[model samples]
Target: MQESLRALLELQKTDQDLHELEQYKVDIPNQLETMETVQSEAETRLSDQESKVEDIEKNRRQHERDLQAAQEQVKKYQGQLYSVKTNKEYDALQAEIQAQKNRISELEDGILQLIDEAETEQETLETIRGETESLIERFGEERTTLESRLSAVDEDVAVKMDERKRMAMRVENQVLKVYDRIRRNLRGMTVVPIKKGACSGCFHVIPLQVVMQIRQGRRLVSCESCGRILITEEGLEY
Candidate 1:
């Protein structure tokens, strides 16, 4: 009984190690996904800034065309002024020329404003492009490091699983089955020592008779509260 108990304890250690490795493996992909999300957001911001710059350039071009058309209208009105016969006709022609000039002035001001906006947007886009490139480089480095860590974790889990199998073979078939069932239900804690007259697995006080039997180490004793196999501190050290 003591030999089987000892084997089960050793098996539990290996199984716990394996469980931790498995959890680490599960978390690696989530870490990678978070890094990818950050990179994607940075790229999206840079793209939007570039699009803003392009739109400003298009608006500036349109303003330039409108200014040119207004200037041409002013030239046509000025030419018509000389052909006016009456004073009223002359005054109307002069007023038409002044109105076209005002339109040209407004278009010019709009073009200037567009030019300033385009310049500012271009500067912002360039800054964001630099930041995005840096972010990509940093994420690339982090991914490489994470991949290396994942490879190492995979190797460790494989080694621990092999060790667990070897340890499992040393225990009796029935005892191993019980241990497996308890471990599955209890999250890898199949064996626990009696600590302070209580079941260490659940911290529940044990009856004197149960503690005595666990100390004897002649038979298997399971905790009534947590259903885990119990051992004395001496049994653990033995």
Candidate 2:
């Protein structure tokens, strides 16, 4: 291939590499954000579980107090039964004692239910705590891996950009300018090979004469439709 055309092809390769590397670099922060969101959700779930357990425990304590107060009422009303003078008063005292006993029973049932619920909550909290720890560790490792990858991508992009600069310098100034402009406009493909007598970049057909000229590798040519620098497979080998 002609020296300028060969240099343009090399420059295109470098530019493509830089383009891909830069894209990857841009994506790293988003990856890290997603990982952080996962970790935050795990932590929030764990916190909610803990709070549920605490609320259950508090309710259980309140039920216990209610049971105690009901028992005290039963004892006080039972003591009043003996002091009552009339049948009506004694029956009222008995009724009050019975009501207190029923209230105690209800309180006991509530306390039992609360105990069961608290146990379940404790179990759930434990499970969630374990999962949270695993999530933290897993996300920690993922974040580290992503950070390392981001650093590596940065280094690779810097190297590729430096290589692109060198390759651009090898092409003729006017050709390099055109290549750079086309690359910027077309997302990094400025020079493309002819495949089946068509421009690979834009898939536009090349005339038979143009195909012959590109195959000779003696001069640089631009595609008529897309204006991308054109070469042939044979020209590349030459």
Clashes of each: 0, 0
The candidate that wins on TM-score is 2
Looking at candidate 1, the ten consecutive residues that score lowest on lDDT are 229-238
Q: After TM-score superposition, what is the CA distance of residue 2 in candidate 1 from its true location, in Å?
A: 3.3
Which runs in model 1 stand beyond 4 Å of their true positions?
A: 233-235
Write candidate 2's Cα lDDT for 1-238 as tens digits. Answer: 4888888877777777777788888798898898888888989999999988999999999989889998999889888888999999998988888898999889999998999999888999999999899889988888899899988998898788888888878888888777777777775477888888788888999999998877777766889898898888565765
Which residues of candidate 2, in runs, are more than 4 Å off? Answer: none
Instruction: Give the per-residue lDDT digits (tens) of candidate 1, residues 44-130.
Output: 999899889988898889888888888888888888888889999999888888998888888888988988888888889999999
Q: Candidate 1 overall Cα lDDT vs. reference? A: 0.87
In the predicted model 1, the residue pairs found to clash are none
Q: Give the TM-score of candidate 1.
A: 0.86
lDDT of 1 at 143: 97
